[model samples]
Target: MGRGWRGAAARRTCNPRGPCCRVAGDARRPSRPRLSRSLSRRLTVPETLPSVPWRGPRHGRRVGTDPRRGPQRRRFVTLAALLALTVSALSASAPFDLASSGSDVAVEVPDPAPVATPEPEPEVEAPLVVPAATPVRVLIPAIGVDAPIEVYTDAMVAAADGWIDPTTHDVVSWWQGGGTPSSDPDNTVYLYGHVSRLEAVFNYLHSVVPGTEVTVVTEAGEIVYVVQEVLEPVGKEALPDDPRINAQVPGRLVLIGCYREPDQGRRRTTHNIVVIAHQVDSAK
Candidate 1:
């Protein structure tokens, strides 16, 4: 038995074509691990990973948040303010019309009332009457004689010296002697003064000529006279008595003075120069 067992064992140990040999060959075969291609591709890790900052927010994280939107909002606000100010200025300066025909009426201006004036009073007049009698003042411009007329009297003739008769001073010679009428209606008013004496008041009377002016100022009015004639008699026979020298003639004056001789104090008795003048008008 032993021998037969020994032979079987040897056969088992050295067999190339038996079931035991096949089992040994299976044990020496390479094991093929299950290769999972899908899982290996899914789990792969990159050699260089992209770097990212690990901080608060990512660069492109929020939706619709552009950086330029704030300045654009400020610009839109400024434009709106400018437009509002322009509209306010235009509304404040609007024009207006002031005509009366429209619903907007104008104020009325009334006409001024007429003014009244007062009347003036009338003037009164004085009554007509003769003024008081005042002595006539005679002015003989040629002889430089300006003296008051004096009535014929002894005292007045004494005052005039022997050139005139003391009692018959200022009286014409024709009026002195009673032969001539005392006063005639149509004759000249004669006045007489001595001219022959050296100091006679009428010393220059002979120089008076026609057309010489004489002024007679009296209380009533002034009378202007113009010389019309100058008379000088030749001799005592020519000294005829006449009432015409004593008359109250209108508009006439007669002046008489004695003629002088060559010898002193020897007067020509009859010859005289007479100045005749006419009255013109009243004084101013």
Candidate 2:
């Protein structure tokens, strides 16, 4: 065999898939040999190579990695290990909150959902009316005048045809359109009587002095009122317009009665008296 063939055959026996080998100068001294510099450069081989444990073709279950793929496998394993360590640290630690100061890393956090607002309630206003109790009788003790209360419609109290004699002789007429004594305080209790020649009803109305107590018996209860003022010499048409009578509607009692003899010529009542009173005690 040729000398080069003998050396190449020996190298194949030693390393089947590894590196190239050099021929020793002497066979007796077993000196360390190296790959040729030109061959190593041409093959792009590393300076140091791992030793192969076996001398034959690898059949089953290779002990180590392939030399060609070793560097890539090692790099992949290292990267995987670093990734595992970073994931473990992130999961085990608390949440990350960035500072106002500048940073290279950015963490995304979603905003919370918006809260719903409730609308305000509307304001309610109080009504100006209340349940009313119809008055049935009125008694003025100072004048010894105890009379039945008569509710009159607007047209009746107006007496366009003139005040009826029998209707006003011994009875008191209540203007139903006005206030009820026991109801809303703002309503004015208007009661009036005609002057009778028998001196029965309002014939003595002029004698009813101030501070006199008047009692009103209603279907609801008894309401007591004290005389606050008396307006005399009032005309029948302007009697209701008096400031004292108009001002006291709430819990007030107003009494109207014709004064002096009727004018036979004019066929009309000449003078009238008006009494204004306020509630002193509430009915039980």
Candidate 3:
């Protein structure tokens, strides 16, 4: 009996089916066949399983894989992509310092100081007063009328050698010359007298023709005029309206007189003869 019991103990140790053996008596040993059968069944099934609905991290549910580690790997991949894009963009842009390439560089520069311009001065005009000329000598060769001309006032005329007509009663009205007191140096010097009545005065003035010579002495100098034109017309219609006639261009003289008629009474009635002459040369 003792030997049989010892043999049974030894067989329990070697035999995997022994009842009292530790390895054979393990409770998980019964599931070994089930694990092998499950593995065989998994091999026969499809490799892919039906997908599960995913929820965000706020929920306590966990992903089959580690959720934190998956998002970290995706973020690392996105960062790598962004870094690559930034490097490519920086390489495509233009470089600075283009002046060394012989091309013009646009840079702002300030302007220099401006120059000042000068204004013109205003003009000054002369005063408005009648200018007086110095009296020179008068010459009338025909009737021995050569004499010195003076500013003959009424007192001077009464005491002068020449006599004025009693009818006209005018001393300055007899021998006329010079312009209005308002005229300038270039004004006309007109002379006039009665031809029919004054027998010694302007009776020979009618005989004067073109190229006739007449002499005048002025304070400035002596000037001689040659007859240029003779005009005869009745009444005021004979006068020329041109103001240039008043403009005594350098040396000019105009002589005026009334025509004579033996039948006409003392009551004056005749046409006026105007002779225009220009200076040829100065009498030295």
Candidate 4:
């Protein structure tokens, strides 16, 4: 063997997989040797490198970081912390309000003026006296009654029922003691007619409805009246003493007739029918 081969062979030992060997008395692979303290100081970097603070771990896992990246990583973390603190302080200060922000500003307003009112005027009075007129004719178109009216004075005697006998049954009698035909509310006009005698004027006076129109003609003008009520049949014997028949109601017209009913295919007078009417104000 050559001298170099003999020297290499003496220093080496073999493993089962290949011709591999380690240095004598060495426990691990060889690395570059560390320098002595005195020499390390002289060989270090001239500029100082910042270092990151040591925190144990992230969550439960160990955090591995390179010491060479300390300066950049520490600067970035400090800036982020300062930004977060500024945001939290601003949010916690006060509620946002637009009106409160401008509370120091001033505004002006003007007042309203006064108003005036006017006074009222006075009223005048009118007269109540109505001119007099005597009733000459009576017209009731509802029961077909158009008859000439005649005055019944002390010369004529009335029956027990206050009925005066006219020259003919077709003629109607008006009591002179009763009211004259005008729009006077203080006067009442009483008219009477025969029902059982021939040519009777008020034979159908009981059939007159409450709204039938009755017109009384006089030398002055015509006075209109509206039927108010047709009183139920009263006893013929009780006419003079009956308060309803003798009532002195002003502006009223009361007509009296015999109340007849069907008896054996003919009409027989048994009671009296009284019709009450009110003067209309337009003719007054």
Best by TM-score: 4
- In the range 27-53, model 2's lDDT, one tens digit per residue, is 666667788989878889577999878
lDDT tens per residue, model 3, 1-284? 99976565445345557655454344456645445776888779787989988875585556655667687888999999999887566555525343354433445557887877777777855443334344355465643445444343445346544332223211113133344222244556565444655444455676777887766555655556678876654343434454435455544667666665567677765466567877566554
Error of 1 at 109 (Å): 37
Clashing pairs in 3: none
Runs of candidate 1 exceeding 4 Å displacement:
1-134, 153-187, 234-248
lDDT of 2: 0.73
Rank ordering of all candidates by TM-score, starting from the highest: 4, 2, 1, 3
Comparing 2 with 4 on lDDT, the higher-scoring candidate is 4
Estimate the lDDT of model 3: 0.54
| TM-score of every candidate relative to the true structure | 0.40, 0.48, 0.37, 0.50
lDDT of 4 by residue, 162-234 (tens): 4566767888888888788764546788888888645589889989989999988876767788999999999
Candidate 1 lDDT (Cα, whole model)? 0.56
lDDT of 4: 0.76
The TM-score of predicted model 4 comes to: 0.50
User: In candidate 3, where is summed lDDT lowest over 10 consecutive residues?
Assistant: 165-174
Clashes of each: 0, 1, 0, 0
Q: Please identify model 4 stretches exceeding 4 Å from their true place.
A: 1-130, 158-163, 264-268, 282-284
Candidate RMSDs in Å, in order, are 26.8, 17.9, 18.5, 17.1
lDDT of 1 by residue, 1-284 (tens): 99876565445344666555533224366656765999888778978899987888557636448777678888999999999887566555534342323423344658888787766667645322323233255677876776655445445545656234413223223222111111111345445666645466566777888888876555564556788877764343443354444445655777777666556476445666667787654443
**Distance from true position, residue 73, model 4, in Å?**
69
